[model samples]
Target: MRLDEYVDDIEQDDSVALRKLAEEKSYAVTEYIDDARTRFDETLTDDTLVGSTAPSVFVGRSSYPNVSAGVLAPVGDENDAEAYATTGEWYQQGFSIDDVFERRTGLLNSTRRSNVDVYDVWDGFVGTQREVALADDPVDIELGLDDRPGFDLDGPLEDIAAPRGPRAFAESARVTENPSVPRAIEKTLSDDDWRAEGAITYLYRRGFDVYDINNVLSVGALGEAENRRLVPTRWSITAVDDTVGQYLRGTIRNAPPIDRTLVWHTSYMGNDYWVVAAPGDWEFELLELKAPGSIWNPDPDGQLYMAADNEGYDGRSGYVEETSGAYYAARLGVLEALADRDRQAKVFVVRYATEAYWAPVGVWQIRESVRDAFDGEPAVAETFHDAVRQLVPQLPVSMAALRRKSTMAAGVQADLSAFGAGGDSSRSR
Candidate 1:
């Protein structure tokens, strides 16, 4: 028997084929949809507006700002001319890539496996990373007072946004397309590439007291009275060895100076993507307390190609740099990460500082099409100023195109800071 024949109300009842037939008349549907946005026929399995990859807001874990900007502002407000500002006002929010792109199907997918309660953030994080490792049914991460209604107050990982600069890329505002051109970093990692790191086993081996910490992870005992950091009371250390001891790790007892930190996100709202942390993301004020090379800048002139994967942040001290060579050399390492994944290419660098934060920055692309126009090396830049100096005199340079690089650099900076070792300030802006 035909399924349509079994339906009592064709107008009220919908099906996949029937919905496709309806959407065939897109002109009429657009007019009807304008009357009501969420008017999708529940029964229609294929109800969609051409399946876009545009950005969208997540449920229950969105809109969490009012976060202090940095650990210690290097420059205090105008009133304190001498001392750096201890706190900077931040504004951040996040949007999903699925809601932004209509063609977000097999070609570009926003999907992943996650323990996070919110569907969008999980899918968004997984979509960008391709693969992720979640602890079990329950996710981990800390939270703040501003996270009452819209954030994950019960865990340690409260996905949030970044403060927007004068030129920031928020979620296309309401799902937009670049008519001129679209620039993106192509990413492809298969099972062989993203192997399991055995995070649970690794933790126990390092003397991480999971059984003792679960209590702290449970009801989020670390949650603040008002603006307190969200620390869980007791959480089952997923996949721990059976032969575990009842003793606590020395790090927790402060036997040898140890620090505890959390990782989160903050952003300009709606249109921010994920990234690994970098030294430049650290505030100059906090960096002062630590040694010169304590903070690590991910997008150094050399490590530009490597997409920021995650961060290691602490609520107390700032990020610790990868102690190795000269500061700029380490900076170069970060830039080159994404410099030439497969082939060699020239890159430009640019820094932005307008009564806000300032740091080393860059831009780069392969010299494939230009026919050796740049020769073996197009042009190399270490600082933001040097990068802009080379690209600016291009005569008829696409202003919007250049702007995209700046936005991308900003994203790299934000993500690096979000995941770096310090402040763990990923939840708010």
Candidate 2:
């Protein structure tokens, strides 16, 4: 399906707004640290901190079984601490990249060294981390840092989990208040025999968002007791997305195909998405065109870096490499819409990353942006080829380049001369 709704194609320059917002917030980094220092003085007694956690946790993958695990707590305001945790709501609130950074930088990651295997113990720092993960809301905690918290904003942003703030070695941590655990999560945790996949799907069915599920799973809170282990935050995010997406795909496997070729378009942050749902059996492909100067492709004069990954009706046999976590993220978006409608389709997603996408904010943006796309009216086309023709000009890369990268687009046997070239067809990096 092609997007011909020229009226809907017009979008405000969110990039300009984001850049301006970044400039305005750039000077606040030092102020943020200074304010945190003041709060530290007021709260810290004998190197111990009395604060509220955002109910956020992080697990690093730098080492094998050995890793850095932490509890994330806001430095300033304790109220509205729940918002500090990662969620789809951030997208709904229309957060800019700078806004994301501001919120993340405000949190102090109080961490300690621990093994990934945390299935039995439930009283120390790791146990407290699990409690925070399982909670329904932010919890007040008493944290003792070995030394003053470290602040360093100069680094590459995380590609999967959202960017983290400063870090500190935690001497001890204890939850001061009872955290309300949802019955579904409580049940899942109680059943040591319940497999992780079933537990995850159950929580999803009970209305727990993926973000919440990811947090819980990352802390080794799920799975069969003996098999449960702490999962790196980055890997867990993709694992949940892929797992949930597979479950969703199953629900629509036998459903009827969409009656018409439908096209939806939406942009968030600096990424543009054109989702095409053509009438056919279940097949999905995600094609990405990264602008030369975009964050992932830094050379201003470099060719656009194009990447793609697809799955047939039976689903993928192995992990996707080209698009990495984004493949699962984008696929989940399409599968969700399909499952909701009780219909399947041959879906193709075109993600164009403009230079305005100056930083990485994680894969949640992809999942949410594509989910939000279905909320708007879709353009209908008589055939799939027509949709591609209409979308050719709006894309950053030429039809030749897209064809080379996209499996679905490559299947089109149309004459190139009739389609007409638009973008540069140079070799993509």
Task: Write down the RMSD of all candidates, one decimal each.
Answer: 24.6, 2.6
How many angstroms is residue 194 displaced in model 1 relative to the true structure, after the best TM-score fit? 20
Q: Estimate, for each residue in 1-429, the C-alpha lDDT of model 1 and write its tens digit.
A: 121221222232222433343234334323333322222222113322121221111111122221111101001121321111000111111111211111111111122123332222312332222111112111111111111111111221111121111111111111122222101101101112321123222343454333322222221111222322211111122212111211111112222220211111111111111111222222110000111111122222222111111121111122224321111222232222322222111122222111111111111101011111212222223343333322333212222323332332332222222233222222111
Residue 420 CA error for candidate 2 (Å)? 4.3
| Model 1 bad stretches (over 4 Å) | 1-39, 42-387, 393-429
Q: Against the true structure, what is each candidate's TM-score? A: 0.20, 0.93
* lDDT per residue (tens digit) for residues 127-190 in model 2: 9999999999998888888888776655433232334576889989999988899888889888
Q: Where is model 2 poorest over a 10-residue stretch in terms of lDDT?
A: 154-163
lDDT of 1 at 236: 24
lDDT of each: 0.20, 0.83
